[model samples]
Target: MTGRHAQHGLTLLELLVAFAIMAMSVGMIYRIMGGNARNAGELETRQRAVVLAQSLLALRDTVPEGGLQLSGESGGYRWSIHSALYDTGVAGPSVTPLHELAIVIAWDDGGRRRSLELTTLRPQRKPSPQVRK
Candidate 1:
């Protein structure tokens, strides 16, 4: 080789291998980011459900004896609350004096249906303080 001769920077095969590695790295990063985003969305839905459940529980005294249904929208999410009687005890088929409340929060994310639910037991009659007889 002469002293002034030029040198090739990179062979075609080497260049192709480098491009493939870069592409794979980018794809992996994208997948991780996408999964993280999905998880974050799910957490938000769950938190909203918890808040709704707490609010409904706070209003337990307002719930009727038989059944209750509430539907509304908040923070770009639609929610529903269903209250009904639940019996687990087996004693002459008797119902408990408390009510079971279920709150569900739903939202559309990336053309997918996402939802969260929270269930709780609430007293039918709120306790009142009274002086002893």
Candidate 2:
């Protein structure tokens, strides 16, 4: 072609390469967005588990001095609470008896088992003295 009639457009090969690059870029972006969405869901589930476990632990005062074991399900999640005497390793009678309270939250996520556990120490309440007649 003469210089005066020179083409001002991309060749077929260039267009094909550009389209390929664009396709790959779009695929990568789609994958990133999908992964972000999945992570957000997993995080939400974990946050809910933590909140449930905290709520169960808040009932520590009601636990018996001999310790209590309970389990139940709520909102598609299975939960359990286990309480036992917490030995501080201090010899002799302590001023306040401590108990270890633990809560486990479990659920099914995308065919996988997910669980969270939280533990705390609480003092046992003493029994009231008998009233004199």
Candidate 3:
């Protein structure tokens, strides 16, 4: 044969273009992954709020009537609960019965303040009838 056949390999220009495209694709994938990670973190933070709220509610249900305060932290999230005696319409000179309890959970969401509040009624005890003259 007068001339030899060219080798069946990619040209330099083709290789360069392929590399550029791959780089672009990798960058896009990394950006997407980062966004997803941020979203998952936010979801976890919200779930912590839910947990804190529920736990406070449970304590309010079980613990004796008094002031309540709790705080905790987890995975870039922090929470707190506050409880106090609330007016319940039933009032006496000495034995005023508080009726409602309030719980507030707070956290930081990307530098923004996020919070949830839950209010519950305390278990009521039957008031003994007063003797009349």
Candidate 4:
């Protein structure tokens, strides 16, 4: 038993190495977590933009014959709605005209311009004929 002594604990060099490795691992974990948090925030912003776009599209039935062209800002986002006549290449007196409606939502994210567009087709409304008094 007196021939050799057992090593009871790590040396100073070994302890330093272990600390360095732990620091590196913690740094990597923090970086990953930060990225995930940023992604979640961006997703939330995009979802809000989609909701706003949908609400704007729901007003399609109220569009006038001359076509709707409106723009405004809401919740730090700028939005625009446009309508145009969509040609089906078919000509007839009884054919109902189709209108192409588009809504665009734009915002500035981290100094970058981001935008989303939603488009839909709707039938144009015709006025009713008046009867003689």
TM-score of each: 0.59, 0.86, 0.52, 0.82
Q: Pick the lDDT winner.
A: 4
What digit string (tens of lDDT, one per residue) describes model 1 on residues 18-47?
A: 999999999999999999998998787677
Q: Report the lDDT of model 3 for residue 98.
A: 54
Deviation in Å, model 1, residue 66 alpha carbon = 3.6
Ranking by lDDT: 4, 2, 1, 3
Where model 3 places Cα greater than 4 Å from the true spot, the runs are 1-4, 62-104, 117-133
Among these predictions, the greatest TM-score belongs to: 2
Please give the lDDT score for candidate 2. 0.87
Query: What range of 10 consecutive residues in model 4 has the weakest lDDT sum?
Result: 56-65
Clashing pairs in 1: none
Candidate 4 per-residue lDDT over residues 28-127, each given as its tens digit = 9999999999999999999999999998787667556788889999999999998999999987989878889899999999999999999988887876
What is the per-residue lDDT of model 2 for residues 32-130, given as tens digits with 9 covering 90 to 100? 999999999999999999989888877666556778789999999999988889888765665677888888999999899999988888877776779
Backbone clashes in model 2: 0
Predictions in order: lDDT: 0.75, 0.87, 0.70, 0.90
RMSD of 1: 5.8
